[model samples]
Target: MDRSQVEIEEQGLGANPYGLLLKALTLIPSWHYFLAFLILSLVFLYNFLEFHFLQDLFSGFRGHPVCFTYNPCSVIYDAVVSKCRVLRGRYCATPWLSSPHLQTVFLNFNGRPPVFSYRRQLFYTSDGGTIALDWLMKCDVSGGALHMNSSISRNETTPIMVVVPGLTSDSSSAYLKHLAFNTAKHGWNVVISNHRGLGGVSITSDCFYNAGWTEDVRVVINHLHKEYPKAPLFAVGTSIGANILVKYLGEDGENVPIAGAVAICSPWDLL
Candidate 1:
């Protein structure tokens, strides 16, 4: 451990340059290595969860709605969905508003719907309540020129479609307006059946419409049928309206005057 030994070590260090680096690493505390390992483990876990769980859940949550029927092999189902080119197209959501909740909020609060004109008709319910029916008799016409056949909207035999909006919604709702406008454009007479005390109409009767309310709809259908006996009558309902329509149809069965009906977003068993 004297001058001779020190000289020997210095000569060995000079020969191998890695000796200094190895000596410095040995002086570091063990805690530093442990902290580095912990950070690496956390990073790996996050990536694993993101790839295996989060991605699939988000993607599936935003998937397009499925078209289904009780009898999948029914000829009517195939003709309605498969043969219809417009309905066959898949829905592609906006990239930024892909989430269902974001899409709903944006559509309700921020979305812009096309404006159209309609003639409002108020019906007095038997129970002293009021119902509003907004009619789009001639929507495809612009500049006094008919885009579709004039007979489609003007003729007594033209088909008529009745629209029933969802709970807390009215004829002026964006979705109802869009549906009415589209149906009218396709040469069918469209009418929106706003619930009692809805569509800006005040509640005159103490009775209120609920999910199972079918009396108002029955009255409307009977009146429409009597008014236009030649026109084929059809109905489209959404949400609670859909539930009401289904119940009405079930109750009336063959007695219902509707030629056909469509129910969208019906909540059959939800509390």
Candidate 2:
């Protein structure tokens, strides 16, 4: 048996839970399909979402008729908006996907989209849950000459935006992917901070992450800060993820290292 299996057995993890999870995820086919239509709908589903959604894949829809920054006369209400150039298009580019209701429900169920580009990996938090992370790096660390190994999460210099999804959600959600894609375009490194176990991350401990469990977020934020000290770090969260981000910010107060943060649809009642 491998060392990992031995460790699992020693910890009484019951037949190596992570091994089983890894095996299952390996068989998880492409996200471009509906249930029971996997093999048969490959060609159809591919072209359907691929061709249709790929048009504004990076430039996704805008939220709220309140502020449509893509429109010339639209107001920018958010304080921490980016300096990136606005691509010429409607504020709500794809009304089909961008509608707040559609986006919210789709995000609630972890919907995937076309051109889902990211480097999916795992971040073992101090509290023990293996948080599934999707890294979309724009840093210029090529040739492996930066002395980076497979273990290193990122190299320095390029700014980063860490996105956290809410309960019952993961990085696969359309809304989260949209943000990640747009951030990647403007040369900002994007990393989706999926909650433990929601995004195919292997469960190692008996405990799973909870909304008020800000320790995991604290560790994640500190880790990111340490990994890319030279890079400006910012955070974005939706729903419960947003709640956690807010708590963390409040906990740290003026000492928070984050350059800025934006939390959309934060669940205040839960806290």
Candidate 1 colliding pairs: none
Model 1 bad stretches (over 4 Å): 1-67, 72-75, 78-92, 139-155
Measured over all alpha carbons after superposition, the RMSD of each candidate to the real structure, in angstroms, is 11.2, 22.0
lDDT of 2 by residue, 217-257 (tens): 77888888987788888999888888889988998898887
Clashing pairs in 2: none
Worst 10 residues of 1 by lDDT: 146-155
lDDT (C-alpha, whole model) for all candidates: 0.79, 0.69
Summarize candidate 1's per-residue lDDT along 1-271 as a digit string, tens digits.
9999999988987775677778888898989989999999977865643333344356764544455445768877677766776554445455565456565677777656557666778998777888888887654534434344333322388789998889999987887877877777677888899998788888899999999889999999999998888899999999999999999999999999989999998996958
On the 0 to 100 scale, the lDDT of residue 85 in model 2 is 32
Off by over 4 Å in 2: 1-112, 139-155
